[model samples]
Target: MCTAAEWDDFRATGTRRPVNFDADGFVHLSTRDQVHLPANRLFGGREDVVLLHLDPARLGAEIRWEPGVPTDPDSMLFPHLYGLLPADAVVAVTPYLPGPDGLFGTPPLP
Candidate 1:
């Protein structure tokens, strides 16, 4: 688990994205901004959430997003976990792996 101080450090960096931890103990940082949707689908739209796993070392990050739920009616879409994250939630630090573009690398889904 990450300590409060570490979490604060991540937030202080001013980065707005979820960090992820891989099964191999690597960390990945997301380079994208918050997802956006149509005006009528901001809150009550289908659930589109990002999934992040944290490394025990606190030195890396990994990031993933769940497919949007068709039943959601929100205009803007941000990756999030349904019923898991709060409205004002932000994940600053996470485990990541180096990618070809110098960002976290994502493996092909099976």
Candidate 2:
């Protein structure tokens, strides 16, 4: 997922990041069922966020499943894309702003 501005940038550029890719050397991804975990943990109260719905098979990167956040036993091995994100992989994009309580809920499937 990306921030609202990042999504805009992706739309404009047509090619997206390899960005932090996480320090583990890839772009971190959360499954549809577990996306809220990372949303609350990482973005928390942030408001300018957006959820990017992507097609796994279309990603140009090498997507790997591995232990992303070690301390969190709930979601240890998450999907990580080991190269740049291509615009073709992004099937949909939606605003993912948090609620008034400053907690984020999962984005609805497109």
Candidate 3:
């Protein structure tokens, strides 16, 4: 997920390198079923958050499935892209607002 401003920048540039990409060496991605996990952890209570729905085949980069943070379920794996995220790869973009409790739940399906 990214902030609304970040999404606008991504559209203008046609690509995006997440803030942590340099340190992590890959762009973090979460499946539809698991997006809420990280959204809540990192962006909870933030109304500006937006979810970028991507088409995997259009990514034009190598994707690796790796274990998530320690707090996640033991068997869960997340997708990481080794290159910048091209804007064309995003099939949809949706606001990811947190609930009144200040926590994110599963986002609406694209």
Best by TM-score: 3
Candidate with top lDDT is 3
lDDT of 1: 0.32
Model 3 Cα lDDT, one tens digit per residue, 2-109: 999999999999999988889999999999889999998898799999999999999999999999999999999999999999999999899999899999988888
lDDT by residue (tens digit), candidate 1, 21-104: 222232222223322221123322222223233232432232344434465444534343222222124533233233343332
lDDT of 2 by residue, 1-110 (tens): 76788888888998776456555576778887667778888889898887888898898778888774655575467887887778888888777877889987766776
Q: What is the clash count of model 2?
A: 1
Q: lDDT of each model, Cα atoms only?
A: 0.32, 0.78, 0.93
* Number of the candidate with higher TM-score, 2 or 3: 3
TM-score of each: 0.20, 0.82, 0.95
Instruction: Tell me which of candidates 2 and 3 scores higher on lDDT.
Output: 3
Greater-lDDT candidate between 1 and 2: 2
